[model samples]
Target: MNLVLRASILLLVLAGAPATAFAQDASDPIGNILDQVGQPAPATPTPPLPVPAPRAPPPAVARPTPAPPVAAPYPYGPRPQIAAPYAPSSSTYAPPPPNLSPSLAEPVFVDEYDRTPDRPMNSAEQGYENRMRSSFAAAQGMQGPLDGAWTLRSDAGQAVYTLLLVDKNNGRLEGAWRDPRRPGSRDSSGFLAAIQKIGTQLTASFYPSPGAGAVTLTLTPLGNGEWTGELTEGGARLGVVMSRN
Candidate 1:
């Protein structure tokens, strides 16, 4: 047979051969030879180098503006530029008169009403005391310890009251009070009236001025040495005080 045909036939025979026929044997000379050569030592596989992961980008930041320094709050900055004295641009604005006289006959109510002692009572004077008492009570009741001293209030007009605890045996209910602020009030030519008390309230009647000279006081007891009073007279109201001696 030709060489090619011979080789082909040998391959075919090898392929069709039973595994046992080709099985390496411990006693085989070929295997013993290959063992000596160590089968060229299997080519060592190279481990792939570890590639570094790509890094993430850093976050963006805003840059601040360089601002001018601010002035201090007090006496803030440099002296402000003073404006020049203005020259008259036009004659539209005028100066006011030096003596702008007031109307003399403007019905003169205030002085006329205040000084007219001979003026008769007006209807508006009614219930004057009730209103005054109510106000006084509200004011005085808010405070302290009034033991023996009684309170007097006016019903018709503002009055200066002088309460003298009269000895009942002598039939005289006499008392005295002075304007604490005014050095000597009794020397002011004001007439005197007697003071009388009637159940939680005191009444004083003076000659001539009927109710005009009457004074009403609201007394409040403040546990300690203090007491408060609200006094009302005519359309006006005043405050008063009485201290126990």
Candidate 2:
């Protein structure tokens, strides 16, 4: 109906218009009519497409930060060394000597006793005790048994010296003698040159001088804490007595 109305109006307009108007649109009369009628309403503006926000670059993949390298304490040449365990070499090993000294090389040992203990003194012991009391000078009773320091004197009471019988072990006796007149004088060493034991008598030889002959002394126990001894010096036998210090 609108088309019919529009056509009717167009016919009316054509009938009433001047030929000068018709000449202006003579070549495109239908097109001109339709163009005037087809003018569209103002188009509603289309919102711009979002463009998807560029996808945010896939969130940058969240790469992990690498740690800083550790600096070496001794970087250039010599590294720290670990100490190795001690190892003894075979070249330092030594074999001991065949025969070591008796004093040092001998391990400590105890000797067994063969005789009885505390037997009664024989008749010879009694006679010897009497001789010391009567004949030897400076003879006196001792408080205890004779074992350690004692003094040796001549029957005439001259040339006294100290005698130490402290080294008797296992029936083997060793002794040393010193002269107090000469301080620090090693008059006699305990290393006896010769010694013999017969019955209750002990014969010992002492080397007081390297070039001189040994001095011999024979000691007989007096059944007391002393010895009735004879000192033979230079082919002369002099009676002597030993008593506790």
Candidate 3:
């Protein structure tokens, strides 16, 4: 009688249980039939979610820079001065023609004094030549800061000389040269010359001209691009100043 009463009470308890508790679980096959056998079902552990590995960041793309505009160009200020890349000691030469002598090929441009064997330079004659030379020198205006007068002290005053440089090509120095010597002589056309720069200093020997003899000049460079020195001819040295043209 007691077993019959116990079984009846258990059947009433199960009948009163909620419907959601009796529901089937797909992941665990045994859970669906657990209540039929009357044993409490263990809680179905939720399978750990597969966390996706973080995706690698995309690589950055590179773009090319645009070229500058063609219609207009950028402007810089006033014209700049350019100095020669070479040192003053360099020189150039062309071999004299086999058939022609140096004098014939490279004749002295002109001689101011029409001196003959009988005719010679007197005090009056020198004064006139000096005046003409001074005038000739004054004709050319200073082309640049380097261009200036070459002055030597004389009894009368200062004797002026001009070495008017025009152009240079094929390593040759081209210009007009004048001193207390020659006829302000140029080698060829009014634009051509033969004043070779031997080493740093240029004596009258390098210059092709007619004079009393080789005119020796002991020139020292001044701080301001001008040269201060002495001109030694016939045993006397006179203060001289030379500059570039």
Candidate 4:
């Protein structure tokens, strides 16, 4: 009985002890190293900063202009001549003739009569024509041909006349006259005569009456020893034809 009681007490002590102590235990070094390697590493921290945009360039400027130029001019002067000097001749210079003929010695009078509209030439007509013809003949027939000038007297109610004689030698006429009662003397009779010639024919430009008693005569010569004349501007039909004798 005392032995049994000691065994029972030992068994009670073993039952109360820890299971781990009672259970079986195992240890493996390789399995422990594999577990540590499988675990992940720690993360790294970040650093922050600002970024810049791109830039551009500058612009340019302008300038001014210039001007132009000019030019110049010219000049002038005088001249010269050819011949010599001469004097004016006297109006009375007579040209000498080389030959003489009896026919030329006889005076030639150029006279034309205009009858009053339709009336015929009368005794007064014959008287005037004869007188002028004779006068011209007398002036030229003599050794001293007709003078360049002479006087003539007439009545109030008579015929008119004109006489022109050209000296063939000088180509100039010494005596040229016109009367109121003559053809082509339509103007007044009391002034100097008007005569003009073209080629060989001559004309007496008229002289109008100047109401009062003013007598005028114009005698102008055409350069080639020819002449032109007229007498008018008054009431009387009287005048003279004298040379520069």
Q: Provide the overall lDDT of each model, using Cα atoms, as 2-decimal numbers.
A: 0.50, 0.65, 0.52, 0.45
Q: 85-147 in candidate 4: lDDT tens per residue?
A: 864476655434533322343233243232122234457777997899899768666523322
lDDT of 4 at 78: 27
Better of 1 and 3 by lDDT: 3
- Residue 3, candidate 4: how far off, in angstroms? 99
| Model 2 CA deviation exceeding 4 Å by range | 1-146, 167-169, 186-190
lDDT of 1 by residue, 1-245 (tens): 69999999999888877664546554477876866784666789999999999998998988999899977655677666689997765486564454554445333322122333233333555478568879976765543323223333334333344333333333334544433223333342233365544444444433424335564555554566434566666646766554443
Candidate 2 is scored at a TM of: 0.37
Best by lDDT: 2
Report, for all candidates in order, the number of backbone clashes.
Answer: 18, 0, 0, 22
Candidate 2: clashing pairs of residues: none
- Ranking, TM-score, top scorer first: 2, 3, 1, 4
Per-model TM against the reference: 0.24, 0.37, 0.27, 0.18
Top of the candidates by TM-score = 2
lDDT of 4 at 9: 95
Q: How much does each candidate deviate from the true structure in C-alpha RMSD?
A: 22.3, 21.1, 24.1, 25.2
lDDT of 2 by residue, 35-136 (tens): 789687788999998776554555557778999776577856458787998877769855445444233332331111222333444577779967876753
lDDT-sorted candidate list, best first: 2, 3, 1, 4
